[model samples]
Target: MIKSVLFDLDGTLLPLNQDDFAREYLTHIGAKVAQVIDPKKFVSQLLASTDVMVRNKDKTKTNQQVFLEDFLHKIGVAREILLPVIDEFYETDFVLVKSITRRAAAARQAIMAVIECGLDVVVATNPIFPASAVRQRLAWAGVDDINFKLITSYEQSHFCKPHVEYYLEIAAHLGRLPAECLMVGNDVKEDLAAARIGMTTYLVTDCLLNVKNAVINTDYQGTLQELAQTIAQIIKER
Candidate 1:
């Protein structure tokens, strides 16, 4: 009885190499902020700070807080100085990164199929970026802001994926049990983790990442075209 479907953005929907996307994202932000600060020193420090934050063990702090605290510590400048610059990056530079991503028609078709089936659709992209940045990425995926019932961004999310709590939080927000939700994603760890709490899982293999060597034992695994058919089958079975 899956009542909702959650989709990951970067690889699952937007079809891209995660490393290439990250490099482009960092380069764009770094270049834009160079006018305000020393480019070499700022990017180097920012990358170092990001590494530290990624390894942070605190569950209480949002990813944004962790990253910003680390960033401010390295820059030693008023946070206000960087706020507008970051905002500008999201508004302008972030959109330019779309050039690196190829639109997946099957992804869009799958999303529409889920919506047509009366299932809620959630953009469950990792909550590492702000809402504006997430929105920009969604646009790259051909998903309008109105497509998803909920879009997970750092501001609204308290936990990152691979943590069952993050999935639980989304279930709570949607007022649905995990058992009634299906998480469709490319990452074995981050997306499939929702299954721990009872959500049905679908691994979109087109952009799959199996870094942890986790054995993918899920029953549902396929390409975007297969997913569209799977959803149709589910509807027919109902």
Candidate 2:
């Protein structure tokens, strides 16, 4: 039986177009840091650095390390100077980007229902951001940080989603097998990828991204309301 539910944040529980949200986030932070560096070049360098971090293979290397290393390499600046600048962006500029997201009452209800069913809850958002950023986003979704048993963050995670090892790591951390977990997200590529290790998947179609064009084959798919109803029915049946 499924005893836990893992959820993605941006496009899944939080209703926002990933591309538009990302563009707004980068633009907002870019404007703030532009006073110290060229805005356009800063955005370009930051994105390039992020790309490098996403592709990094060293499991021991934190996402922050990967991003910082690549960013510092491009700017040719001392690591000490860059830390304060990045800190300023996350602390101040990042808060403004929350306006792009929409809150769903049903999403919160769905999460509550899962908890009531005696299932463990995990905010399995991609471990690209630090815990503070993840906590901020959770607030946007009407989910309190304390609601989840564990929230994935760069400091505690070594792998990114779509990698089976990432799911395996979480499973091991929770002392549960993959088959006893339910993976829920709006992205076909990232969320559905957990199925390879035996976790059942529920695709939230409202903000779906079928990057690999794989959603057509998934049996469990629906909008947030529909998902809430499905979960309710499952609990009733149980």
| Best prediction by TM-score | 2
Off by over 4 Å in 1: 48-61, 235-238
38-72 per-residue lDDT for model 2 (tens digits): 77888888788877776776887777788777888
Each candidate: how many clashes?
0, 0
Q: In model 1, how large is the Cα lDDT of residue 87?
A: 88
Model 2 lDDT, residue 115, Cα: 85
Estimate every model's Cα lDDT from 0 to 1.
Answer: 0.82, 0.82
Q: List the residue pairs that clash in candidate 1.
A: none
- TM-score: model 2 vs. ground truth: 0.92
